[model samples]
Target: MAIRLDDITTDITLEIDEDVISIADFQKATDSFLGLVKELSRAVSGNADAASWQVKVYKGSVGVGVSPLSSGLDSLRIRNVMVSGLRALADGIRPGEFTDKAIEHSKSLASLFRKSNVDPNVRIWSQREESVRVGRSVAAGAEKLLAAVYEEDGSVDGILEKVDGHGKLQLVIYDVLNNHAVKCEFANEQLPQALASFQQRVEVVGRVRYRRDGMPVSIRATRIINYPSKPDIPTLTQMRALLSGSAST
Candidate 1:
């Protein structure tokens, strides 16, 4: 997402007077420089990956487990790096004032999450165009729940109204696990439980984030062993042939 600014027109440079040098004046100059750079970064080219960041889905399971990676430490690191850079630019500023500017810069970076539409401040997750387009097909499968909710009459309108109020879609995920026995033409395990688990795992209650192989991510029957609900017998047989030993039950 890097934007080349070589083609853009710009003519601006800041220089200080060679004479008068006071601690207060030096601090003022540093604050001015940092403020201007911050504003320019917001208005012109967006921040490099150096200033903005995101969380990646690490793992997921049903009644099993869910884990998220980084916990957003990467973004915090970026903020710290930016603050250090800002401090390096404050040559004659007092140490206290320089530290204050660093804190301010970090706060500015954190504020990017709330300004999803603005340049340099937008969040990768809250970008509506991308999510709506990419998640459209995947989200469609989850529509059954919405349809079920709609049967209550006010559910659809109410949900839409809530979304409008918050300006974000909401969702929830639930995991269900159970053991059952059944005979299938295609497989040995009962697939109704799998299907139920999938549908139950996906629910939209608020701003939703989607990730590949991430938590709340469900694997469908068609996705793994084909002809879901068919005898797991063939799959088991294939596994046994490949392993030449007992496989997980």
Candidate 2:
């Protein structure tokens, strides 16, 4: 008799699509699920001698809710069982494989969209119909506030150079505004004009650093990242290996 481990797995393909989110976000979500499944499968294999751990029994419907004969079969046990099913289906589908499929899918979608000649005029609807009396005035005020900072600093490049990549860049920008850079209370926020160059090139974040005087210095920086359009199974596997210290290279 076969056991049905989960009601979710049947007719439940991990619903992934290009429109809902970016390729990276989709892959991260999928890989997280896959990694957990892989771990469960590993545990199941490692516990082969444990009589209750039967992969085939879990696959059939009759044994579905029949708790594993093992002593400790509970939440973790059930998780492991479900993960085993996912792992078996995946058959070692790695991050790189998912990324490759995503890329191919995106290309196909883009081609279809182009062929359809879908008018993207809806994007401009807001521009034409927007009521700017209140919101626009507020925006203008904010622009004026930012104008002083931009003009005084010239460019935000000096601060941006210290940061490594895009993530850091975004973080820094948030840090600056969140910490009230307009007040200039933070020394790091008072960076030289060069850092402002990155304002146009990338997002600038203001962060605080300490000077030799035991005073906090505000620094504006952004992350420099070379993001790939799509990541495939091999790339993810290599990344995982590197992260896990198991990579041969």
Candidate 3:
């Protein structure tokens, strides 16, 4: 089954520091804004395609709100995440500092402003009338600080919150270090296992991909090891006694 949300609305406001705005500059700013939000959405919800957008450009700034493109898109969650993540960035909060949400400090969430060539240090606004002015600076530094994604043999354990997509099957794993959900793809052979393990804690063993800051983003699962539910888990003493009995035998 799938889930869909409706009429969800929120705003992302961008303040450009320019005396005379040209068409090219405007496009760049909007592009950067969209790219920033796209990364934020993907980091938060595993999807970045906002539905419909309404651009309301005020005298001093441009505020953007979006509509759904199709069913099952949570544009609201995307916007909320944009707010929280921007707050973290604007306040100079580094990843793993106080709290690390799905949106990492260097999650490429602000990597577009550098291309914008417009000064965003003046102001950026969220749905709650809050301002985030670090868009440009964040974009600039991220290029130098954030690492590239690479694959390696490893394991990552998290709750199998969801499985999505039609042709391309993906599983969403909610990592505990942060509520960040990592989306992993499995072969058709592994689909049954992934589907059966939904909502359970499972460790995916295979080639894993990580973001620049060492966050797992992709896991090409060779196997899915479902951890025993709490009720099914034996106590430490019980396991030890069982092991002792086996040794004696």
Best by lDDT: 3
What lDDT tens digits, residue by residue, belong to model 2 across residues 52-125? Answer: 43222222222112223445434354343442332322232222212222222222222222223432111000
Q: Please give the TM-score that candidate 3 achieves against the real structure.
A: 0.50
Best by TM-score: 3
Off by over 4 Å in 3: 1-122, 125-147, 236-249
Q: How do the candidates rank by TM-score, highest first?
A: 3, 2, 1
Evaluated against the true structure, the overall lDDT of model 1 is 0.26
Q: Where does candidate 3 clash, by residue pair?
A: 4-72, 51-68, 51-69, 52-67
Root-mean-square deviation (CA) per prediction: 21.6, 21.9, 11.1
Which regions of candidate 1 deviate over 4 angstroms? 1-12, 49-249
Model 1, 131-203: lDDT tens digits are 0111122122222211212111111001111111123212222233311111111112423433443322222
Ranking of models by lDDT: 3, 2, 1
Cα miss at 7, model 1 (Å)?
24
Stretch of 10 with least lDDT, candidate 2: 120-129
lDDT of 3 by residue, 95-144 (tens): 33223332333333344344556544334455544555546555444433
lDDT of each: 0.26, 0.29, 0.59
